[model samples]
Every structure is written in C-alpha cells, then in structure tokens.
Target: MLNIADVLHRWCRAARPFALATVVDVTGSTPLPIGTSVAVDEDGNAVGSISGGCVEGAVYELCRQVLRDGGAPQRAWFGYSDDDAFAVGLTCGGELDVLVQRIDPIRHPHLTFAFAEVADGRPVGVAQVVDGPEDVVGAMLSIVDDRVHGNAGSGPSSRAVADQAHALLRSGRTARVAIGGQADDCPQSLTVLVHVHAARPRLLIFGAVDFAASLSQVGHFLGYRVTVCDARPVFATAVPYADEVVVDWPHRYLEHTEVDDRTAMCVLTHDAKFDIPLLRLALDLPVGYVGAMGSRRTHQERLRLLTEAGLTQDRLMRLRSPIGLDLGARTPEETAVSITAEIIAHTNLGTGLPLSSTSGPIHRPAVREGAVMK
Candidate 1:
C-alpha cells in the first residue's frame, strides 16, 4: 500500500474535504489484500489503491457520495455471482468488503497520528467500529497508547477492542477481527479492522560487482532497505540501485550495523579478504538469509577456509554458497533475479516451483516470522 501520510496530510493541510476508503475484509483470492486504503478528495483526486482494477470504480463512487452527502460512513460489499445483474463486482471470483467514510482532518484529530505511525515505520493498529451505532459508525483510532491517538469506543467494548488489536499487531498482519464477548449470554459482535505496517526488511549486499549492482535494485523494489558495502572506495563510491553505499571492510561494516532476523546478507565479494571473514561472521548471525557468490571450486576452497577458521558443518550449512537457484542465468541481472527468488522462497517457506506444479494454495498464509531466519 502507498503511504497514507502524503495524501491525507496534504488534504488536511489544504483544508479540502475528502473521503477515506479502506478494504476491511477479504475472502478467498483478492486483487488487493484487506487493510489497503485510498483517499478520494472532493474534486475526484485519488491516491493509493484498493482493488487494483476490479472494484475501484465502484469504490470511487462511494467516496464521491460520501463527499457529496457530507460524512456518511458506510460499509460496502463487492463480490462475484454466477447470475449477476450488477455491472460492478470482482470478475476474479472473490469477495471484498470495503469501509468508506468522510474523514474531516480538522474534526478527527487522531487520524494524523495514525498516518504518522505509518510514515515513521512504526507498527500501528487501526480499530474501527465497522458495525455499530450511528454515533460510532466512523469512529476509529490508532492503537498506540503513548501517542495522543487513543481508542475509538468507550466502556467494555473499547477494552476488548484494544486487547484484540494488540494481539493482531504482534503477528504483523492486517485482517478483520471481531471484539466484544459475553458474561452470561451471546454477546454483541463488533467488527474492527486491524492494519499493521511493520518496517521494511534490510538487504545488505557486500560487493560492488555487477551481480551486486543488479541485486541492489531488485532488493529495493522488493521493499528492502538496500545497502551496498565494499572495501574499494572507488568501486563503492555510488551505487544508483542501493539506498546507501558504504566504503568499508565487509566484515567491519556488518559488525557496526544492527542486524535482526529480518536482515538479508548477500556476500558477492569473491575475494578471500572480504568473503572469508564476512561469511564467518554471517553464518552465525540470526539473519533471514546468508548468501555468497562464487564458482564450484571457489566455494569449495572457501568452505575449507571457513572450516579452518572454526566453523562447524551445521553452521556452514546456513551459508548458501554459489548463491541463488539454478536458473541457468547468463547475465548479471538474471543472476540477481535468481538470487532474489531464492531469498523470497526462504522467507515465505515456498518450494520455489511453478504454481501449476504445486498442489496446495499458491499464496500460503504468513505461517511464521519470515521463515524463522533459516
């Protein structure tokens, strides 16, 4: 999803009337996932996307209606049917439930903080009373306590909603959740959409070679904070693909940096001075993926060197030497894709086979935390 901060803040600052639309829920396959949002202003200016193409036009009209009528918050369902009369529905045979509301920035002060949370790369949960009384229809707030943006509702309902929102945020997902429980009987069901925006993962490419250059671009496109580090100051002066270019020893740069389970380490530096020391440090770290680029003989020699340096077989196994899948890649760009594909597969726990050859769902749920840093 595009940054909501830019669109909403601009409109708010301009004092122009606008409507905010969000995909609250989705079932089966969908063009856009739930929690995707778009801001439609009074003059029909739109930013961000909900359903790429399928239900966008219909959603646009809903936004316009809210703008024309002045603050009419409503939930809409766009789906497919065999015997259909409506001209507007998803042709992909999926269902989408969207929540559209006229949000006055001047009136709803909390929305600014929610947009800021997304901009700052801090995770925030948005809990809205989707199905509720008229007074609380468009009531929504960011699930952050220290911030001025607080809960939307009052009483038992608000407490239950906060707990549910926190549980969903910890998993780092966006979905529709039901709150409110019973004491003696079947309690009321309040629907809240929990949208969590975690910071993008980091990808460190330790080389200024052709493959590293190409991989840097691909990593940025895949939503990673890309950094290209090399020992040669001239070679590492500037890499257009990477977000940052650092001229330092690969191992030294890594040691000074903060790497977590979401960090991806790509060691493209074939020289032993850079590769051996960096790979030794990388293999033991808790990173999402550790890769090194080299020929068969080069990799074997590197393995021997690593073993002499006190790396065990189990620790050495974590290194994907001669990195990337066997795609018969000839060019540096193609090799970059091969390596990127392998990293994505490792992160998602996929077999890296064609969807047609797979039996189960093509898009498996986010089963674990980015594939356990393995």
Candidate 2:
C-alpha cells in the first residue's frame, strides 16, 4: 500500500516476501477507508493497518496464513457480531472485505515497480483484480501517467479494466471498478481495485514568521509539500521546517506558481501591504484552503481593502480571516495546531464541532470516493 511504501520498498529490496491484506470494499460504518492495507513479513513483522485496531489481529493472522501456504489471494470479510462479543469483527457495526495475497518480486514484479515509484515520489497506480475468475484473481496492472504496465489478464477485459483504472488514477481515486459481466468481449465479471499514489499536495505559507515555521512543520507532518515565502530574505531563510524557502513578494510568487484544488494557501503576513495584494489573488484561485492570520480589527480592515480592490462578496466569503479554529491558542505551536485543524476540517467538510456532540459515522465518505484528495 502507498501508506507503507517505504517499508514495502525496503522489504522488496532485501528480497523479503510478505503478505499484504488490503481493504477492497466496505459497507456501513467503518473507521478506515477502502484501500487501507496491512502487510506481514515471513518473520512475523508487520507494517500498516487495515482497521484502526478492531480487525487488525484477525487480518494479521490471515496474512500469516497466506504467507505460510503461499497460495492464491484469499478474501476475508469482517463485520459486527452482536451474538458473539468475542468474535473478530468491527465493533463499530461495519463490514470490511479484505484481500490477502502473498507478494514477492518473482511473482508480483509489478508491485515491486509500484513500490519503487511510490518511494521515489513518482505518481503511480496499481489496479488489482480483487474479484474475478480464479485465474484472473490477484492479477495486477500498474499505471504511470499514460503508460500502462503489467497485466490484469490477457484479453479485451484486461484492456477495458486498464482504461478505467487509468481514468481513476488521473482523478486521484482508489475505487472498486466492475466490468465484463455480459459484454461480448468478456463474459466473466471482474472487480478491480484501483489504488493511486499521487504526488503530495502543496501547502504555500506566505509570511516566514514564527507561526509560519510552526505551520510548515505541521503541514509536512500532515503530508503536504510545504513552501515558506517572504519578501525579506532574512526571515525566509530562517524557516527550517519548510520544504522550500523562497524570498519573493507573496503576490508575485503566487502569481507564477502552480496550484490546484488540493493546494492550501496561508497568508500569515498580517500587514496590509503584503496581505492585500496576496489575498486578492489567493481568494480568486480555486484552492482547497485560503486562510489569513490577523486580529478582528485587522480582518475587518482587510475585507474593506479587498472589497475596494474589486473582489466580490462571493470571493471574499472564501477567505478565512483571523484564521484557525477557536482553540484560545496564544503560542505559535498551539496556533499552528489550530490552523491545521481548521484546514483539515474545511478540506474534509467537518463541522468543527466536538465529536461528542455529533452522531452517526465518525469518518464520513470522502469528497472523492476512495481517496481523500486534500
């Protein structure tokens, strides 16, 4: 799995065989999403987790069994059991369909290539036949951009599945795709799980202040490629946590940089001279998050300036002024946590309310069906 690509790459390079249990499907409430995986090596060492803790023990043993037998991939299901409290199931009242398979360079060279691509920070996707005829089961196809590698099968059905996988990969989704039940090209039905390992999203912080440094560290921990930018070279060079430090005007830098819907832009330069021009452009961009740090008074003044600068109410509404959730944070580190929390809440469509006050599934369906884009 991409979550433990480093571990998989290490084991692969050492010529170690391991069993991987991947969550291919789920029904009802579940803690972890589909595509979550758990891997176990021959020596009983393990990496990654399918469920947070509920079904891991059962999945671990399943991996061990697959490793011992070295057989075809096995599909196991786990669901809540009201009749038996001691049952190995999800207490949260959900069902998980996991596919456990033995992985080695000799048999699954495609997986080895996928793991290596993920480790090298290249975008790649692996489409595995989770449900199909016995001969097609566990077959995998790897896709990197337009090029397709490996083989799901040796027919038109494989080509059809690969086409779908390529589309899903471009959209950055890890989803189950079904094909070939009644089609003339293929009679047997096949269900493939397309798992994507895209590049990390960008988190651009414009300020180079202490708060920016702290936020940069948190953003990196959260798996974003963090960039700290400032007009002053002295401050920009001091931010040790950012992946890239740029000494340039915030607005100018943003104007030339690439951004997408998954990108998050934080304007920590509370000053009007920097915040005004930078935010004017940031608010118009279709980014995942655009938050500015300032006081209530500063927020009102900033809004007035933006309005005067021709930004409409709709664009202005997108700005999170006096940025960050209300955590009563005063220190830079605490403020960073608060800001990151708000960014996650916004990206995930969370209510920003305490979990105790809410009901229903704790982990909602992602904006994109299989993977959380932002």
Candidate 3:
C-alpha cells in the first residue's frame, strides 16, 4: 500500500474508473507481502505490482476482464503449476490469493478520501467487504481513530465490523475478520479486509559529512524517514540527501524531536564534543537503535566519559559504538550499506551472517494473523 499510494492518489483524483486487486492472503514464499496491491485502470494501465513482475501480464488481463464484464468480487489464485504451459503461476514456487473489486467514486462518496488519506501519509485504514451479500461485496469503511466512514451493513453487523476494523487499525496490521453480531462472535458473518496505513520508521543521522550523505541516501532507500541534524548551518544547508536537514546541536535537536520505538539514531559526528552529549541522551531514550561511529580508542574514551556523567552500564550497553556490521567497508557508500545492514539485522534479530555460512531460514517466519475464513 505504501508503495502504491502515489499512483492511487493520482488515479483516484483523475476520477477515472479503475479496479483494485489486493493480495489479501499468501502462502509459502512471496515477493510482496500481503496488503500489497495493484490498481488497473479502464484502459489496462497498472499502478502497482502484486507479484513483483512474474505474473503481472496475466493479472492485468484478469483485471481488464473484470472492468469490462462488471463482475462481482473475484478471487484469483496463482500458484506453481506443474505444467510449464500454464498461464499464471509463481515460477518462484509460492501461492497468492487476490481479491479484486471495483470502486466507483460516483457511487461511493468516501472513495476519493480513502485514497487521498494514504496519498497524504495520514493515519487511516480501510475495511473492505470481500465476501457477504453481493450488495456488500465492495462496501468500504474508513478507519480514523475509533470511528469509521462508509457502511459495512445494517444494525448490529455494521457496528461489529467497525469495532473489529478499529482494533486492526490501532495495531497497524492487516487482517481478515468475519463480523456479525459482536466482534469475533460467529460464523454467520461477513468477511472484511482491514488495511492500516502506517508511516515508515525514522532514521536520524547526526552529521553532515560525506559518510552522512551516503548513509542518508541508503536509509532513504531502506524506507526510513531520514533526517540529518548538524550544528553547523553551512554543513546542514547542503544536505539534499535527507528528508530534513536541521541546523541545531545534535543533543538539542534530539531533545525536542519525538522518537518512538521504531526510530533509529546514528551519531556519525565522531568528535567527542558532539558525540558525548548526544549519546548521553540517545542511549537513555526508548529508540530501537543508537550507534556511534569512532575507533576503538574513541569508543573506550566515550564509555569512560558517559560513565562519569552517571550513565549506568545498562544504558551504555544500548549503544552500538564502532557501528555497523564487520563488513570491512572503507568507502562511504559501502560504509552506508554496512550501517543499514546492521540496522536491518538488529531490527530483525538476525545474526548478520552470510547465507552461505548460516543454516537458518534466509527469510524470517511471517507472523501473519487476520483475514482468516471460517
């Protein structure tokens, strides 16, 4: 959804008729995770991709047919076909279940607002009816806080659906739920898909050096809301590499900024003058990662100074000094990769070992929950 927000915003506003096909469920390995979508216009132009590029041609045709025939909600499964001649299947050996629905803005008043919400990076969710009475098949509910827009059904059924959708929105996870009387009450229910449009995690880089630029670019590509903070106005002025370039003391900037469990802070200034105070506050915060770039001697010095400033061993332990995985990176770009790799590995709890050296599964197990059929 994040990847296709721009395109959705465009088509939804053009008032052009289109059909959206979403990956509601997946089995085994998949190139794109669930909740990913592709919208096909009346002319067969596509906005996003659900299966990387493997079966897009076939999916495009299916979407075109739906638009032409004005069909009911269609469920299409693409899998590994034993016969090589089969038209649409994952050659990579996985299975995907897609639910395609047509949304007419002329009929559904909230249709434009839903796409605009995602396009503007707002906190919003959509509860789409995939199965039930044919009339409710394409029904949508907008999730904002505890309230919902649009209709799911009449009386108790609508309230039940809205409550379940709000639960999923708060959790910021996608799920398929069947709602009838009360939330999660019975099998005599309507199947709905809830999608949460959460913002990407933040990566705050506290430097404006060559390495910082490279790291900023890599962080941006890694789907981070990257910001570069430096005390020197001259250094901060030219940082087109980050989402935001702030001219302020690293500690001051961090003190005023809001950080959450998903935020990662990197101290690349290397100088103790800037590093000491910043690390003092960063290590004590609830951020997911706090790493500093310096030599072994510098790291030891930093630890001694931080300890003298009343930082406990527990707080110091949170710091990832001499940052990045042991990739022997020398160039700025390579160092950026190494740093981002370490960040990813830390977040995923990965060992950071080469696949050839490790026997564990290359991809982590999907903690998928929701959108289950009874």
Candidate 4:
C-alpha cells in the first residue's frame, strides 16, 4: 500500500496535478471506513483506494475533471444501499461520501504539514466542517499528528472536546462531532469530523520464534506498524524481523515506547520470566488489546506469579492471557490466524457471532469524538 502522505509529498514536490479523494463519511455497510484516501494523477494511475473497486472508475473520471481544472475540489456521493439520486453509486449496496480535492501545498500549508507528519509515521487528525463543495472554510480544526488546534471552548466544554479528539486520534477514528452546549454559549450545533488519517495501529510481538516471523508478515499486511521486541539479539535480528525488529528489554521497552488505544501487544515469548514482566508493563499503557500466548496451565501459573508480584485485581483483569481466541489452533499458521482473529475481534469489539446472527448493521459506527459523553 502506498502511504497516502508519500503520495501527497510526491505530488507537491513534482508540482504535478493530482486529485485527492477521501472517504469523508460512510453511512452504511461500506467497504472501507471514513478517512480512507486515494491519490489519482492526471493519468489513470492511482495510489490508495477508498472502496472495494465499487466507485473507483467513477472517482477516477471525476479526478480527470479535477486535474483539468487545476485540481478543483469536488464532492461525490455514492450510495449502493440508500435511495440517493446520484448517477454513480456503490455496487455493494452501501453509502460513501468522497471528498475530491486539488492539492496545492503553497495554498494550504496545514495540508502540507499533515502530509509530512503522516509520512513521518505519527498518527494525526484533520478536522473540518464542510459548508460547501469548495469549503476549506470552517472552524479550521487542525490536529498535527495528535495535537489539537482551534478553540475547543472553555472550562469543561473545551477540555472535554479536546480530550475526546486526542483520544480519537490515538485510536485513528474519523467522524463528525456536535460540539458547543454546556452551561455556556459557544459554537453550538457545528458538524466537525475529526479527520484522523495518519495514526498507524501497533503490532507488538513479544517472542523471537518462527511463529513471530509469520505473524510479523501478516501484521504488516494489515497495515500495522509491526514491532518485534525481544531480549535475545540472536533471535530478534534484522533477518528475522526485517525492518520491524526491536532488541530491548521487554518490560523496559514499553516504558520508553508509547501505546494508545489503537495499539495491540502480543506476548509470544511464552516464558514466564519474559511474559510476566512485559504483560504487567503493557497493562499500564492505554493499549486497546493485550494478548499473551501460553497453555492453560501456564496462564494459571502466570496469574499466580502476577499476584505474588503485587499486581492488583483491577490490573490483572486487563490481560487476555492464553492470548488469541479458542480456535483449537494446533499449528503455527493456525495459531497466527487465531491470534490475528482475536486482535480483529477485540478491535471491532465483536461478539464472536456470525454476521447472519446479528440484526444490527455490520459496520462500526462513525467515531464521533473520542471521550465519553457523560
């Protein structure tokens, strides 16, 4: 996958005309989530994709027009499931809102900065309220990487919105927020979507085993910033982990590293000495899912060791020891699948039921601000 930031940088540096299509919103069972982007040059060649080959042709045609017009911003709506009056729609029966904008780094300094931050591997958000097709004109809610911009408000209201947005950026969420309405009068009823495009999901593999190698390959396939950290330099070498290897003390490694709600940490070390200390350290970080591999007996003994180490009930409850789901996985490949499945399940908060068993919409709700409403 071509990093969207790199695409923007090339377009800017070459001074070539290209249209950028961003999936600003998705109403129903969309193939990709909001904030997905694609850059199409004047030619049909494109980098990145927003949908599952559903509306690319249409968006490409629109890009041609955008390029010809010096890359003017255009708005195109695709609704496969909804009864929208749009000539080009999604084939998978879903709704998608594509924001096709022309890139001019000179005109938009913030956008250029956003591209730089994203290319630098820091998760960021770009929030804006659109009033028209050409509207770069709203409360310019800019967040470079994870930092918030503009006035979020005052007292509880400001802090609340700002905190929520930072949290969402950490989780890589893109959705609208209805802000302003606390005991004071601010900008009430404004539609502001926190455009989080840069934050990369983390893949922390704790072991230096052969299974870890396969897991690293799959983790990169899913676009996670993979990090295979192990104490043994002999095992966790550049050959095994390639570009994604970290040779450090497992427990101490986490102390210097940052892990947020979008982060996933897996304990493949299997040894109690390595697993216990690292798992305990991971519990303190705001990581979303913590997976530890071992047998049932190992988990029991690990828990006892944790208790003896002065770990409290609340902290112990945060671990997903024995890791992965109960997929009856026996082989390394099957075990990898089980581990990945558990990560996905935890990411989506899945109930482990078939889609047919659920009556509600299969899509995740567009993340509205990050912090709790209450």
Residue 345, candidate 4: how far off, in angstroms?
1.4
Which 10 consecutive residues of model 1 have the lowest summed lDDT?
A: 365-374
Q: Write the per-residue lDDT of candidate 3 for residues 161-271, one digit (tens) a residue.
A: 778878877665677776663445433368887877766678999988889989988988877889999998888876655889999999999999988667888899899
Model 3, residue 368: displacement in angstroms?
12
Candidate whose TM-score is highest: 2
Residues 217-283, candidate 2, lDDT per residue (tens digit)? Answer: 8999988889999999888786766889999999999999988777888999899999999999988
Q: Highest lDDT, which number?
A: 2
Worst 10 residues of 2 by lDDT: 365-374
Superposed Cα RMSD, model 1:
4.1
lDDT of 3 at 299: 93
Model 1 residue 129 lDDT?
A: 70
Q: Estimate each model's TM-score.
A: 0.79, 0.91, 0.82, 0.73
Off by over 4 Å in 3: 83-87, 131-137, 144-147, 155-191, 232-235, 304-317, 356-374
lDDT of each: 0.77, 0.86, 0.79, 0.69
Q: Give the TM-score of candidate 3.
A: 0.82
Residue 302 of model 1: what lDDT? 96
lDDT tens digits, residue span 1-374, model 4: 12377777767666665777777677867777766778888666788888878788888888778877853467789886456545567766678887776655555465666666767776666665433223332323457645655543334444555565676565666665666554554333344556666556678888788788777777787777788889999998863433478889899888898776777888988898898888777776677778888889989999898888878888788788788888888877788888888777766666666788887666665433211111
Q: Model 1, range 1-374, lDDT digits (tens) per residue?
A: 22476567667767776888887777766766767888799889988887778777888888999889875587799888657656787776677788899887777666676766667777777777777666666677666543326555666666676776777666556667766657433145577776666667789999998788789889899888899999998788778768899999999988889777778888988889889999889888888789899999999999999999999998998888889988999898999899999998888787988878877544354443343443
